[model samples]
Target: MNLMETIHLHKNDFSKTERKVYDYIVQNPTAIETATITKIAELCQVSTSGILRFCQVLGYKGYKDFRFDMLHYLHQEHVEVNSENLFDELTSKYLSVIRQFNNIDQNKLNQLIKQIKNTKNIYVIGVHYSSLPAKHLVLGLQDLGINTYFAYDYMQASHLYNTIHEDDLLIYFSIEGNQNNVSRFFDLTNASKNTYMITLNPKPKLLIENTLILPGYTLSKQSIVDLQSIVVIFVELLLNMFHNTLKED
Candidate 1:
């Protein structure tokens, strides 16, 4: 059983404090990657000793060992899962993804929102499965009255690139940061100072002014589903901000 399933099966065994720690751990795996016991306890509004007990329940010697094992479990799970049980996997995956997002620099997301509002047009590019997120982002932006366009195919992307202006915002979505066609689109969009990209990996060969790194292994097959879910959450958050921003206008 995966970490999530294990948690579900043994949830009744956890004390209230341990349950809080468990929920926080399952929800925020990325945070667990760099978090201290103190930090986790503070975030969960529990005591440090409570967190140590939570770790012990998971069969780890201590918090450090538990975190190490959790990371390894997530890494292994990412590689082994296929599309068959992807939905169930995502249940746990999204909890972790949202935790990562919660840890992101809100100031940076605010800056990106400012850039979006100032841009003349927004172009979103993705190919194949990655296009699923691109379309979702475009719809969210459009619903908020932002002018946005998305390209699902290389040919259409090239045509759209021709109309892109220096003031336009370019957002690229790809699970793997290195797709030939998506790379080409990045190269074309590089001429625009407003270009931005979102991918599982923040590091990309093609230069962009801004990048949103969602934690997960891009090379993993399960990563795409996880990334797509993250994108949906991001869109919802962006839309909320857009609505608030418009109200002030």
Candidate 2:
């Protein structure tokens, strides 16, 4: 089990001091990535020994080992599985997903922007409900004067993928991330080809190396609507950020 899972499974067994430390760790996982044991102890209002015992209880050798595992856990995307407020849940979900982007490596985003600017051509692809957001992104990119192509179906996308070259880029969107055509496209493209996948699923089936897993509400049939509602905002951010960066250059 991961650190979060371990915490959840055994939190009730914790002593008062340990519970304080565990709660702080759960709420501020990102902070722990750079935090010293002394600093964490201060934040949790506990002694350093208390923190060490907490780590031991969680099956780690020491605080450093626990901190390392927590840092690694933060790398994987997470999604909320429950919501109490139905009326505002869509907005809440989008806000949570967008917050995840704050932790994204700025260098990685800059590299993608540079690749997009340097590409010979750009193609956007998505399957089923994912196509809606993909189309929205293509239109926004086109509005910014980027030459963008989009393929809405498997046959059309296969034909377009054939023409893709080294300098070309493919930006794919998928809520589920396991579309048959998407898998095929990955097979056809060279490892050197520029590709980015923006997925709404936390535990996507595709599991490609180049993927951004965004959190989204997937509780029921209306979940697709939830995704569509907020993806445009993200697409707008990407297009405008690229446009502004180009002008600065």
Candidate 3:
């Protein structure tokens, strides 16, 4: 279930302080994407420990866990796919996008592959539909015995920033490339050089240096296109390529 549903089910059992946290969260859902626990506590006029108790009351380990789930819930609020007889249209779009995949910047992809091969740890990040590719990459990396962590984004006090080394890699999977959120993510790493972004946006803003632009159709409001499916195919093929290249002798 989504975060709001979980909150609703447990709201009645919340303490007075917890209700304050909930009210602020519902009023500013997107702010939680990058808000720290301390910031939230101040905004809700509650103690930091109060926020922790609120998260625990909602069955989360803590505020970090709650924020991650909250971001997932926010991203879920999008237009659903329609099952119309636009098979021909969708097929044509898919073909067009697939052909564009052939034009992927090999130089950048090679650099990305090298980074993945050399890094001891990898953090795969994405929000909304882009999470599909992030998750696919995470599982594929694990099959190759690589250490991978899948997260919507970095959180305060999360290990993503604390244990990240210079040799580590941070690969972002974003469909449109959220500039502000992604820029902050990069800043959190102290402007790490071992960063890469795989995105469909032709002109993504605040993109990392190693970004590789891939072919994709942006899902528009009420559109009958399934662009994410094409990205999945591309990521799967990319993973297969990685498997072939990085597997042990």
What is the Cα-based TM-score of model 3?
Answer: 0.58
Residue 34 shift from truth in candidate 3, angstroms:
31
Give every collision pair in model 1: none
- What lDDT does the true structure give each of the candidates? 0.71, 0.70, 0.70
* Position 160, candidate 3: lDDT: 61
TM-score per model over all chains: 0.64, 0.64, 0.58
User: Which residue runs does candidate 2 get wrong by more than 4 Å?
Assistant: 1-85, 179-191, 217-226
* Clash pairs for candidate 2: none
Total clashes in model 1, counting residue pairs 3 or more apart in sequence or in different chains: 0
Worst 10 residues of 1 by lDDT: 217-226
lDDT, residue 99, model 1: 63
- Residue-wise lDDT of candidate 2 within 1-249, one digit each (tens)? 676888889989899999999888776665564457887797789999999999999888999898777766766535554666554755654455454454444565677788778887999987677778889888888887889999878778878877777778888777666645565554533335378877755556665567665434333224535366545566777777798888898
lDDT of 1 by residue, 1-249 (tens): 876676667678889999998787666666765456777788889999999888777777898887767666666664456888877776765565566665554666787788888887889887776788789878888887889989998888888888887777887776656746555543643445566666665456555556665555422444434456666667678778877887889
Superposed by TM-score, candidate 1 places the C-alpha of residue 103 at a distance from the truth, in angstroms, of: 2.2
| TM-score, cand. 1 vs. native | 0.64
